[model samples]
Target: MKNLLLTFCLIISLTATAQRYSDQAYLQDRAEKFDLNEETQNIALLQIASDRNKAIKILSENGLLHPYEKKIRKDFEYRPLTDMHIVALSRYQEQFIYLTDKAVLSNAWAGKFYIDHGIQNPKGMAIGADFLTLVAGNSELRVFQNGQKIWNTSVNNLNPIALEYDKTTGHFLILTEDALYQLDLTLKTMEKVYDGSNLTAMCYYNDEIVLGTKDGIQSLNRKTFALNKSNQKLPWTEITSLKNIRGALWFGSTKGAFKLRSDGKYDYYASKRWLVDDHVVDLEKGPDDTVLVLTKEGMSKINFEPMTLAQKADYFQEIQRSRHIRYGFTTDLTLQTPGDLSTGYNHDTDNDGLWTSMYLAGELFRYAVTKSEDAKLNAYEAFEAMERLTSLPDLKGFPARSFERDGYEIGLHANGFSGEWYKKHVEENGRIWRLSDDEIWRWKSTTSSDESCGHFFVYALFAELAPDKAWRDRAIHQIKIEMDHIMDNNWYLVDWNGEPTAWGKWNPKYVNSFPTNVGDRRLNSTLILSFLQTAYHFTTDEKYKKAAEKLIRKYGYDENANRPATTIGFVEGEDLSDKWNHSDDEMYFLTMPGFVNYSFSEEQKTAHFNTVKSHWEVERSEKNPLWNYLFALSGSKNIDSEESAWWLREFPMDLIDWKVDNSHRKDLTKIEPNFRSQTYSEVLPGDERTLHLHNGAYRNNGGSDGNREYAPYIYLLPYWAGRYVDAISAPVPN
Candidate 1:
């Protein structure tokens, strides 16, 4: 009867809300990496046409509609070495017709072309329904139908600079250096639409003729041809090209390409995330409603395919296993070259245990929600790796940060810390490595409080949720051993040198040393109390309970834990305590689940629940799915479910750390940088910004050139946790 009651309570706690939207097709946009092998200055124009048969075949063979479909369907066709100096290009019946300095020609068709006619020194060209038009030598307008000259007219003094076919008016629009003209093919006459200079590009949009100029966009009424100057600001003033794609006006400027949204905002695409170069030369529509932006070096095809959040989860799961796993722990991949996955090599990190715990906890929740055998297997594998961390150092219960094979540099610098600052810190704490009993490996030491927080959080879940009694017993044993070591060492993680490692101190004197506003004061107090509560809840150890009560009553740890996050502000002259520590946000939230679940009394649960709520209220603006979902799991009904779903859907399919820069964007409203380090007034969407696991999500910009790929645990943890809590739904068949 007692076991039945416990199981019932577990189910109620794990599933805390009603089910949300099921999986259905939604547009998920991702950038496909494509670049040319060598540089060329003679390239004239880029043209793309739909290749449905090729796209379908590639999709059918790989069962993945991505990577190959875009490559095969919308691949750019460019001249390798054109000494003819191609001046203009257009698509006619799925074939490219290009005009050069000497003559006009077809890529696949070899009929005697423009030069054979009277056309010479063509300035620009456009393809019509049954004919092709060009401003020949900027002196005359000529048309060709069925590979034969059809019509000719004079526009010599106009000095035509560009040409386009307006299907609505059945006329070829021509742009001169200082004027716009419409050439009626049927009437065989030319009429000037509007006189304008500095007009670089033009496109038909929303029943109006839109023009790109040196300053910004200008539009003209098609009927009256009255020009209206645009008040809209762009990412760059020098508009190079324009295209109307699916009702949205896309502007390609010297900086990047941006789509004008209906909300008067711009969806800016810049950096290596979207283009090979910021100088967008042309914009065109591609297969499957994709948008192609052409640069001097290469083209960027933004593919928007139908996908559910669940499908995205599966994709990331495969990525995690294939690229990130090292010795059963979710590890880092160091690349020899930027943006090149082929050069990536798996490496051990200092927080292997912490990172793996988060991933294992995610898998645990996944198994709870779906009963997936794969999730169970993944969780157990990560648990074994963490289990090794504790025992590898040969200390009673001290956990190593990470481990690598012998003969690798085992210094503080090799472990990612460097210079005199880290050198002094490591010297004060002793060496950072200890050899295993077998003497074949070296384990990194000086495990910090966040590592302990992660272990306590995940091990507590394992003790309660593991399928077999043996696994549950093992988890409980780990909790007991670690808690005993802390208590025995006078509330500090005593390292191999018999001293507390830096950042692992939790004694009253150490934690209370900082002022209350200093984040460390509140953070360390919450961590130790949570550890004790978790240990006591699982083991029913009176000593663990006594240690927690003593801290609460004598050291005021309960009060410290209850302090609102708003109280955590800068501490002058205290480098560690000053400003906001984004990493502590991870530690606090990760520890809160264990802390709230294993509270000794109802009063403690209520107090800690408010702490989680207070922290979440501050973080609500970021729309972070993980933080919001975890807070909802703690029994808050005001969770931002819609925002969470938006974040998950907007997260880019490509996880490569491409260099991203949003500082040049005019769409964003910058704020004076504050304590939280929020640079922008509004947070960018998940796909628009760079995301690192421990960094602030509100950061508008900053990334390296595809050198690193973060573990997918950042998404998996929040997604599975939300699912387990019934805040998110499983996919339903379309």
Candidate 2:
């Protein structure tokens, strides 16, 4: 009766508010209503208190809701902006002006404004003690009182490149590489202060004039034009810019940037961690408790505010709500070409069964923890999507990668899928995308074994956590169907093409074919044993237990599970060792539930625990919160929960697929490529330009020629799962 009323209300609402709109039209409603991009709108939605129906209703009325279609309700909220990536940052009065080669006026209390003023007309800025702004152009010096220019003088007449104004002497110091000149406010009287070969940058600190030269940093006495005794330590000779924050001295250089504390300790922030690029061009302390770092390529903002874990959870909750919602179900979203949230989701996303199952598992954890009605409904919705997948193409247990509205196909080129994949395909949608078929729907026929692992892993979670006896029984029954299909087909997912799908092989023949030196043979053995254990626990099926025992006794699957990946390196030119696969890492650890909770014997439990621990230890340096959360389950004393919280806190506020080029960066320490590595990072996971699926993430040093956004399950699974397992403490609501 309640659902009927809600459905009736939805019908009424759609009748009243609906109109004929194109997919592009779906992309642009919120900006017209509340004036923010989708990501920013999502962040604002998350900031509202969870139970604040009034605020939620207001956002709904204002058309600030995400997906542009989700109804405004107390539980329907999420966030997108977790980053403050920028081009340049400056301050005028209380305003934080961002400069992406243009003036972008930013305010916490007001909407931002932008103009292309002096976009190229800048070389130096001289700020007076009165807080007036003076911009040095190639041929002129323009002075501004507030944000408005007051006066201009001809710098071509002065023949100076660098400019600085002195507060104590009430004079201006104009500089070129060859000479430094002292001039009055009128620029009429000029006295040469210092003779130098090259002057790079300058700033006022400690009530003295500090000039950055090719030689080193030197302080000059303005009173007599004499050099002061300057014996301060520096990391590099060529300084770009300097700022004194409170009392600690901070400076940028050709090498990197660092700070000298009062207690004589040096704090460092190099690589992509704190720098957009390592050619540090300038530094400015901006309003709103932000320190600005500008480079030749881009700008970054460092907020002084501490983010609590509850806030972090709130952030990811909304991120999952907004970007990762997936038709209120789940699928691998097309991140290569981002969805505008206007036309909604792309019709051609792959791995629906796998991705949706993981999301469903995460929702299971969420429901178990909060018992929120929303979580239950969401879990049910996803289960409906996933459980129906096995039936989508008239197959009993073979799960397709995805199904799409008839005309959509993935990876289409001028000729179609390209190479052998192109079997008479052509480009559509303005030659940008490939298209095929003419019917109601088309499902990807070729599936992989990874999908199988994902499916069973999530199924186990659902069967264990489903709220009611009916839901539990349903989950168990479905698991039985898939498990039986695999067993009947001799341990493989037979695709629609009547061939074994790639990566779906699990017979002893295939599992044992992999060389023991590589990770796959051991990995497949571990996973199949886990699957058998999961099936047996739910159905009390003796066949499942016998199968697992056969693998252990005959194929040494138990010994296989105890093998650490580090102990046996991937050999070159073999089946493995091409590269370290983070996806494989995901699959291996995701299979851990059978080891921990499926009531395994002490021997099997110890073996699986060792496998989980070895993998987790090798991955500790990555500091991925999800990995850490899963690692804690092994009951290893080496768990690093503190880093887990830090990982959540460091998630970027901006979730857009902005170009993050790390090429030509100066601060990175490069390591030699090996089978154990994709790309080495001098910084932690939080410090990278973007987070992406581990498969292709390590190909380039930092960025790809193109980009894609990712699912928040990348965040949510680890966060909520961590909370459930007590690896991390749940935060109190602020």
Candidate 3:
């Protein structure tokens, strides 16, 4: 009996040793699979050693490798949108489309559905098919039409990574990491359809299952499970997504994308330059066979027509110049004599005021590509002409006038001048005026002179780009003056100097009041926060930090006070009586908290983060796409939540209500045709009959007038938030 016990103990010890080695082998295999070098491997091992479960989890969560265990661990169940399984759907005739990112079901029609994952819920629009399908993690399969239960009896233990309905066979082909399965929808059963291959992407083509694997494309007979042996030259690598576009098989892979002809030939398309990045996460065929490619950075529209080297070079040059203009580096905003009119189409209007000319010049410059010098010259001349207008000085600052014709000045138009000047001056200063103009307008208010945040922003940009430190210093000084002029004793800012002026249009209670006399706390809080944020970026000044924090806390950051909700429309003063200007207030305020939180103390950051998160949740739930997009771009952690994804995919619905009225003037009513210039109020769903509102926001030259302007700049926000890139530089966790 003692000898028997010893033998048993030995057996147990051997089993334990084998298990340990197995786990270690699994970890090493995954590390290599995910391209983790020795250094990352060591770090991962250390992380695993500290908490074997958590370390294993982090690695697997980051797609390093599939966990060794059969069941997913509880702690690492939640996946980011990037890692989630994506189900792209288009209806035959329905306007609403459905996107199932992992377990989240987002409808383009009804907005976002806040259904929990792993739960059996029959949500979203139902197709007339017998079997309902959904994607969960790597698995895509047919479930019961009413619930989350899998329908295929033979599909047990099969880990499906992708699925497509084979209309020809009346079945669904499921692509797993290892193999593929064909499920008979009518029979409610599945069979091992294909073997001896590692499948990646699958689609139905001409009543057959067109399978894309590591080897190549293989077509299976619809009736019989036998593979077609005659033709199999479909070249694909790491096929990520496959779509049937105009009868051709459009397959997007990690290496690039490809189109397989019905005749069995293939054309390779590298997405590195053609698309956003090498990793084409998804692809869909848009109008005219144009491919909508989604990548890690963003989405891009790719025209399949191959261009010559010269054409490519010209296209890239145009793109580069457009990018510069979009970032507000330079633009033409002036009318020049004897215009060549080669680059942009010119139209002369009766109201050829300075503001109009400046706006026209900017519009032309924004659209100009080949004739860049002409556009630049025209813009420079317009700025010079505007500067020749008569001088009028006010206590707060000089009024930015609207009309400038042959060197004559006109008083500022209320709503148009302030915002337009701010946008043009700060965002695109080089095009507006020369860097030397800073000294000329050093103390001037009127006389086509620079004042306000618009001028300050322009000067700042010029100083940053210019060679001279003196020019930069002068710009900074001008910014200081503008900051002082707007900020009141209570830390709130007055919009403008004139009584009930355009500046005070959004701040009605403080209308027509000097900075000292103004008492209203309006959307200027957001504007002031933006100014301080910009100032901090330029000078790294502690004063800007203090001002930003003060304004944030006083307005909506605290959450305890009955402060105005950032999601609501802005009405001037303390009056909640009038309907809020939802577009202007919300868009500005939505991004402000995130900006402030990035630079604030830990406690303050937490408060602002929570406030922004809460507001985002509400905005997302309400299907406000513009706000949702901003919230997502703001790096809201809750974006990874199932609820946020559902909302974001549906919020574009509100944009459909936008309309444009050409009759409405900036002075009479806030009407801007450019979708980029619109605030939340302008885009909000309401009965305010105004021209120039687009049913859906229009994207011009890959950029919009409003929040879309900041899309390119968003990449810098994460770095500014103090998140170190390398693990060694990160703060040690408690």
Candidate 4:
């Protein structure tokens, strides 16, 4: 008798725990009526009594509701339960939906409206008439109403890889690797739909279910289950990923990415030449229609905008204006100023210098938009500046080596002064110099023979943009000289002279010595391509084309070959020789050989167009947003692919943490004992960190005071990618 009593007690406790609410307590006290099905009536009665225990436990566990002590109250009398009542109760129980109005009649379930949250992992989610379902890694089918998971069920052998909804039958179709299953909620069972293929992803469109796999993409009628391969020519060797954005379907593979069109065709992007390291992990469309691509190496955002004829005409006028400035015309001082006479026509912080090279680039853009003579003349002036700058000294002597100026000595110690002085010295005289203190403690200048590629791009731009015979001849002459000065027997630019001078012995600047050489392949390719492109623009010279092709082939023209898959010898600020000292360096360098093949191709346009796309991806991830913008400017036909627009909209410059540290160095309190006997003090202050953006260019985290300002030119990115319009369009803040 005692054992029986204990069993009864245990049964009662279990029953109490299972109960969802108190039995119709509120209904008995209220005048309003509620009619529900037998099961829902029981649930409604329990819910009225405010059974906190059961509802709280279920909602919290399902990630539906936060735990709160607030009680829910509704005044309604009880009525007969029905099917609609059961469905209504189920829908109300979901966390995503909220009750705005009570059911008007007993047993009615159609009074509430539901809003949906944006889809998460939508590529694999199964859609149904009233619900969406997804299987987690644990093989549980979690049913969601309005983006809130209502319930879940555990099923074995159902490794669902893709999902689609059959609106006609209100059934959810699940695509597994081996078979397909159709789930019927009313029957509480799953039926075999179809079988026989390695399915990867699925989507529902226009009463058809689309399934993508390794073979190809196929469509099936939702009700009939009739399968038909899509007419589109999808190059899917291994369809590893898929996404649907704004009614468009995107497919990804080892080769590249493609978008499905309305007429059942595929448009390929970032294949062959244009994707940087093509192991795509994710693809998304932003709110502004920008395409965001995340890859194994980095992320890329693309914006495409179409160029209009009116815009082209405007660009031509700008090109004509630039030509006037280059040819020594007195223009508005605000926009174009002659080179400073005192500084020998060097570009300075005062914005008085013509910056002929920059203007040349602008001219090229005009020529590209509308082939004009003025643009060609401006381009020639740019080449002239390059020729003159090349004759300047490669190194200026301070306590340490610095950029040269004045053809004699280093410039005075001033912030943002060295680069300007160097520019002035090179522009005026055909000799590199350093400004220094003489025996009398007065400033003196000296000259040197070392050379650099500081202004080489000017010649390259002119070679491409120049239309007149004089401009073309001058550009060719300058190119040959610059090439002879920099290129070694191996075709790589030797960093410095090999002879000793009065100031110091000649030292070869290793690849790591200057930030500019970190990606030497890109620099060389840009220069070679510039020449080839210019030749193509002019006399259609096959020799130039062949030369460019040879260089690109030797380097590796494609995106994959240009990037190092592994993180070896890739340390920032380390000399190139030291970084690539290990065996892996050879492999990393080997990847760049695709450039050669791309450059040599005789086709007017080949897969090499993809190279721009690839570099944009790489640059985006490299913390250089400008390059991405530049790539879009040149490669994209429309602004739809630009990430810059989104950045401007969502993330403002004020949110960025910009810091600068300027502190004196204590370690340099005393000069070296050996050099103490020298006439001038050699002590230099500690490096300062600051942010400076001038002339539509920016530098972040600039190191040491002397070297605090760094332009993004080292990457050969947007500024040097030959997108003249985009380069000039960069907004300069007041």
CA lDDT of every candidate: 0.75, 0.57, 0.37, 0.36
Against the hidden true structure, what lDDT does model 3 obtain? 0.37
Compose the digit string of candidate 4's lDDT tens values, residues 18-116: 211111111000001112222222221211101212222111111121112222122232222211122111222222222112221112236333323
Rank list by TM-score: 1, 2, 4, 3
Model 3, range 583-662, lDDT digits (tens) per residue?
A: 43233433343244333455654554465565555344333333433343343423322232222221221111122222
Better of 1 and 3 by lDDT: 1
Model 4 stretches astray by more than 4 angstroms:
1-154, 184-189, 205-208, 214-236, 253-256, 261-285, 292-734
Q: How much does each candidate deviate from the true structure in C-alpha RMSD? A: 4.8, 14.0, 24.9, 26.2
Cα TM-score per model = 0.90, 0.68, 0.32, 0.33
lDDT of 4 at 354: 22
Clashes of 4: 66
Residue 461 of candidate 3: its Cα lDDT? 34
Better of 2 and 4 by TM-score: 2
Candidate 1, residue 403: the lDDT equals: 88
Question: Candidate 3, residue 320: CA error in Å?
Answer: 7.9
- lDDT for model 4 comes to 0.36
Instruction: State the lDDT of candidate 2 residue by residue for 462-560, as single tens digits.
Output: 776777868877777777887887887888888654667657888888877767767787788777887888788878889988877877898788777
Please give the lDDT score at residue 142 for candidate 1: 73
Indicate which candidate wins on lDDT. 1
Q: Which stretches of candidate 1 lie over 4 Å from their true place?
A: 1-19, 38-86, 93-95, 100-117, 132-136, 144-159, 184-189, 409-416, 422-430
